[model samples]
Target chain A: MKKHLTIALDAMGGDQAPAVVVHGAHLARERYPDVHFVFFGRSDDVQPLLDAAPLLKKVSRFVHTDDVVQAEDKPGKALRRSRQSSMALAIESVKAGECDVAVSAGNTGALMALAKFILRTLPSIDRPALASLLPTYKGECVMLDLGANVECDASNLVEFSVMGAAFARTVLGLQRPRVGLLNIGVEELKGNEEVKEAAEILRTSDLPMEFCGFIEGNMIGAGETDVVVTDGFTGNVALKAVEGTAQLIGRLVGDAFRSSWRARLGYLLARRGMNGLRDHLDPNHHNGAVMLGLNGLVVKSHGGATVEGYATAIGVAIDMAHHNLIHLITKDLGGVAMDRQESEPLTLETDKQAESKSA
Target chain B: MKKHLTIALDAMGGDQAPAVVVHGAHLARERYPDVHFVFFGRSDDVQPLLDAAPLLKKVSRFVHTDDVVQAEDKPGKALRRSRQSSMALAIESVKAGECDVAVSAGNTGALMALAKFILRTLPSIDRPALASLLPTYKGECVMLDLGANVECDASNLVEFSVMGAAFARTVLGLQRPRVGLLNIGVEELKGNEEVKEAAEILRTSDLPMEFCGFIEGNMIGAGETDVVVTDGFTGNVALKAVEGTAQLIGRLVGDAFRSSWRARLGYLLARRGMNGLRDHLDPNHHNGAVMLGLNGLVVKSHGGATVEGYATAIGVAIDMAHHNLIHLITKDLGGVAMDRQESEPLTLETDKQAESKSA
Candidate 1:
């Protein structure tokens, strides 16, 4: 018999909490019958919601906490004051081995801060990166460092490439994912110092991955590479830009269809096609953004996500837990780090020297 | 009668070359009866195309130049060796006051490098930024520093905001355009030192524009502001991402419509609406990217743009020339720079001191 995958939930987090969290868990429970949930929030608020879903109630246990982290609470303030908060407690549950993975639809900064503080990073990882799967023309691709660290060095970027590739491999089921560094231009001489340095290291390093030197922003949606690595700032902006553009086009198409009776009739005939298009691009289908490099798994659902979206986030957590994603990432990272140490010790030393000099 | 606006064209540049250039000139001439053109390329290559368009030939003069700058030519190499090249001669015409503006569909880097070297920057401007129009939900908006300078300081961003606002006011016909600094987050403390410093400056400055504190990438397409100011690196990436997303959605929508007979029938009936959308989001409709801050007006058309796209680029040059865009930018910059100098001389001194100390 297989062991049930356990997931801790931050029930009081997102805009529409406890209710969506409970309902989402019920939906996920239907899909993964062998999954159990540990809900963290005020039991009074969560108990009533769970009472409606008997299946979810049967497999879920509530951990009562009166304190709740506000959406606007700064990362530092939350880390210091929100020890008993639902978000923090959920992450702590993962740290305590009570759950295999933690899922939160909370303030991103607060969640990331608490997860990092509680779980810490993998031994070879310097900083944890936020990674998500984005639908591309070719297929779905994984992009990393999505607003985790505002600024990242060459080493941080290299680490993100490894993590993102590992993610694409495990989540998307690619055998050997192609990784590319995001830059303004594809030329070797383009971009800032850090990107150039990262490319140089990736090109010469003994990392067991296909490193496609550099890719521009336009090529990202073209699925030119399976894994796209960038600093948190660029990654966040690029992701948002892609989302915005997709939404804008959707709106424009709707407006056009509504313009005339003929068009509206055409829309009726093409409703199925439109639904297919909508479903393909829907955020609910691509809900969870995993905080990679963390010792324990932490999946962050979009703050404004729906019940289905939350359920999808739970599904991602389940899949990752079942597959032992953290173990795979650690093994791959160790291999790459060891190879770099053996082959390019001088580069690593230079990086350390640069960091110390800056410090 | 209004005086005619003379535009110098790099007839040998772009993929389609003299054919598209000459045909585009004909289209522009039809739209603006008072416009004149100077074609710069090998006469044998350009003359035949011009002869076919008798109306364009009537208002155009041909300047023969056999030296063509290849698309792969490096910027530095182009600037040094391509003196008699069509692109160079066309810009020279603008510099010599023979043409009000110079339009090229040549290499972007080559055009920017040469334009900077020949036209030079305005006295108050430190760098020339590339600005372009983008379709937004609200209407149309302008974004600047597309790919001109890869790295920018606080002052460079401030200059871009000022220049971008001027472009919006003069070209887009906005009375007082709202200007925003692009960042990963909208919070005051978010982003790097340069962005934070620029925000601080813009917030307190006496620049005659409504300074929206910060805008995220998602809000750009929502048309949150009339002018979006960012560094060339971020700007270029964001622009490409937007384009990529649009194309990806287009492809997805196409695939969806083709999936079933019902969708095909619907598409046939809704063809008009789709056409409306196609025209709205078409890159051809938004063809020109102006190299702002240059002493002489230099418009860069997309290398692979269609005849209509090239004609639209010509229209942008005509609009800028008619509105005296550079003169307006210069005046506004002078006002802001003077106010800044009067109010924050210490800030300027501190910047210089920091630079020297770092040096």
Candidate 2:
């Protein structure tokens, strides 16, 4: 493995910004000591925390920026006032190749917006997508277009399949990931025209992935495919619903154990095993959601992520950098344009980072 | 409470067919003594089962129909071969008012098509939606457009909200159920044009429901609202994904208990409380999915549902009939058309029963 990877940090972002950023970086450093971080935030706000953790300061560089992107800012507004902001500067460093990757605990739309404008998408990619790792019964699967582009055409779906497959190869270390389109049904003739057309194109294309025809939402957690491809609208809803179900189950489990004294005694005896189950369901275990298909790697950590969760997000950035994610994406997109050229040329208007980000 | 109610059953429908149908009806009868059943299936297939359960046969009438609707048949194909089919006859009885409501453990698309053809929709409803009860943390909530319409407009969404609200009122016994428009984000200006426009219309229109502005997929299981309204495509994916998550958590919990002897012992101790949790997660508890906006009530049960599951489905139909679902839906949709006229005339072409059922 290549050593000495420097990650650009959007220190003044997220719900608990500078402290979580610095603390998360320190925790990640313990796991991968050779890694370096360049923090972009107001020095006064970030430096005091970094100073408290002496070892983290030794290998890190802090670049002061007075402006922090507000969580509520629309993508267009965030970009219009983007220059010299911590998020902008952090992304710029990666554009300049000063950092191998960028990690941010920030608003998703703002991060996607900045990442798209600063780094741009790969040559073959029509629209870059947001991808995340979800824990399945067997292991993990990569699901894409979480919320970046709500409306996608056949070309966009096809592109997502390619990007998703490549990310699975890089992060999950799968050689030929099984890529399936997310649809209402697995029937050959199911879904809208775009989904069917995309499946048809994928069926014939020589993409560097196993093209599973169609997989339903229930199959996502059953480990039916290594990578799931879909429009952001369906993908986003499915993901959040899965999360909601997890929460519902967790609460139910807790309530069940606490309902009576006998159950409480059993819970005590099964505490070790139950803890393992909790570990499986923790958001920290699956913290990072990568904005794929960009020229540079950009990983978005949850805004409410704790030190451990943010550190896991950093680990994702490190993995992407170590595994040559950009090159992998480029390689996957290589054969896509050749097989299918008859579809309508893609439009850029529908692929906004956020709903009100038209400007 | 009104006790005497007649329900039409497509006895030859579902994977377990006449056996599950007969058993489920008997189970429901034990709970509800004054109920009557009209069995629409081959008497030879259903007769033996009814003979085994004498009390069921006492309150039921059998109408022989040799033809059975296959699960794989497209909606249009099913309709083309509709005459004397068990599903068709069962729905036709509802149309003819021989039964208070129709319950079928058949394919959804086929049931929706036959229901729409024979019963027709109410004057105010442009398209009927597939609605189901989902198990949330606190209790249950109604979710609509499970897979009836792939593409929905503002008018259709507003219609769904109205229908879903009425159904919640009928089944859940809430006078004015809190209705939420399912979207990717809960922000004011998130999701697509249809969702935004629907929110605007519902905000001003005198719909007979509490218009909770927007709810995310994650909040569905958290009991954010009593009714969730969305396009069929997203609703289908979200519901199935939630089911998948439940399966995953169940498997994980099972594995955790089996990992060691101590856990196995603990499992024995916690068996009672754990069983309650299992009941909460059981598919049988949330079995029925109603096809709303029709002139008469139509309830679709899971094809693979066991006796208890189909009983729950029957229970849903009983509730609908008892509370006058059609009247409630008509009242809920009463003031919607007057306030919104700017949207393009509702298109019947986009609202398909199934993907390949455009015919």
Candidate 3:
């Protein structure tokens, strides 16, 4: 028999929380029969929802908590005051080894703050980054630092690149993922100081990954690389821009089809093809945004996600646990750390020499 | 008789130059009979192309220049060395008042650098911004600082807002345009110090425009505001991301319709509706990216634009000249400068009081 993996869920989070959370767990349970769940929310509110899902009820345990984190609560305030909230408790369960991974459809800032405060960062990791799989023309690619560290230095960007590579390898099952740094232009001297410095490091570093120079925002959709690394500010804006454009196109297409009877007839005949396109581009298929560089696994679902989207987030968490994502990241980051240490002294010497020459 | 506007064209610019430039000019001449053209390039290469279009040849004159700026030429290098090149001469014509505006499908960096060098910036404008019209749900909106300045301060952002509003009013014919700062979040406390500072100023200042606080990247396509303001780095990335997403969707839709015979039949029946969508979303329909805040109007066409796209770019330049865009920007910027001076003393006093308190 396969060993069962436990997932801790924030039952009282998201727009429609307890119902979608419970139903999503049942869907996940059906897909992965050896998975169990630990629900963190008020017992009275969650019990009725769980009762409807018999399979989930059989393999679930509950840690009742009356407290909840409001979506608009500040991250600092939530970290200090909402310790017993469902989102916080779910994170705590992962830290305590009661659950293999934690999944939450809650306030992103609050979840990140609580996860960082409770679970801590992995060794040699300065900051944790948010990563998600984005659909591209060639295939799916991983993009990192979605909104975690908004203003990142060269070191933070390098760390994100490493984390994103590990994610692409573990989740996407790629033997050697080609990573690229996201910049305004592909030229070496195109961006600001931090991005240029990061690109230089990635180009020269002796890491166990394929570094494909630099990629522009348009290249992200073209699937030019398996892993795209960027500072949180640009990454977050770029991700949303892509989503917005896709939605705008979909709306325009619908309006066009509805404008004429001939088009409506065409829609009926092409329903299967259109369905395939819709399924491929659906947000539900790519729901979870994983927080990397953490000691334990944490997946954040969109607060406005539907039942199917929430279930997909749960599925992402399961896959991470099944593949031992944390272990893969640690191993790759360990190599990065060693490489940095060996090169640091040489880099310092070079900098000092250049400064002396300029002086 | 209506006043005629003469446009200087860089005949040796873009991928398919000389031919496309002459053809595009002819198309523009057909649309606006009052517009004349002065083409700058080698006469040997340009005369044959001009001969093919009798109407254009009758209304156009050529300035012979053997030198041309390569696509890969460095902006600074081109500015210093390529003074006699076709692009430089076209810009010089605008500066000399020989032409109302200059249109180029050449290098963007080269054009910007030369335009800034020769024509100079408006009196109250510290940096010239790149503004382009983007299609939105409501109709169309203007976004600025596309790639002119990668790093911008609060003052620069405020200037972009004013410039963008003026562009919309002059070109899109909006009575009172709503301007918004593009940010990671709509909350007052989100984003970096520069953005926060800009928001505070826009919120408080009286600049003869509607300030809609902060709008996210997704709001760009939602038609949330008439002007979307952001730093050049973010603005450029967001614009390209939108274009890339549109292209990706177009590809996916084509693939979907070709998947089965039914879909193909549907495609034939729905061809008219699909054509409408294609026309609306075509880059050729919106081909002009104007360099705003310059003393003279300068329009940058896509480097790889076809004849129709090039013609559309010429149309944009003509509209800007006809509406007196520079005069509108000067008037708006004059108001902004007055507001700044009125608030400077009070801001200085507040800063001193805060410093004294800290001491």
Best by TM-score: 2
TM-scores, each model vs. reference = 0.94, 0.94, 0.93
Q: lDDT score, residue A153, model 2? A: 82
- The DockQ of each candidate is 0.58, 0.65, 0.43
Runs in model 2 lying further than 4 Å from the true structure: A1-3, A337-359, B1-3, B337-359
- Candidate 1 on A1-359: residue-level lDDT in tens? 24788899999989899888988999999999989999999989999898888888999999999999999999999999999999999999999899999999999999999999999999888778999989889878898888998778777888898888878877888878899998888999888777887898787766657999989999889999999999898888889989999989989999989989988998999899899889878988888999999889999999888999999999888878888888888777664533444435655665686487346
Interface RMSD (Å) of model 3?
Answer: 5.5
- Native contacts recovered, in order, as a fraction for each? 0.81, 0.79, 0.71
Evaluated on CA atoms against the true complex, candidate 2 attains a DockQ of 0.65
Q: Give the local distance difference test score of model 2.
A: 0.89
List A-chain TM-scores for all predictions: 0.92, 0.93, 0.92
**Candidate 3 lDDT by residue in tens digits, B144-211:** 88989877767779889988988888778887799999888999878866687778877776676899
For candidate 3, what is the TM-score? 0.93
Model 2 CA lDDT for position A332:
66
Chain A TM-score of candidate 2 vs. true chain A: 0.93
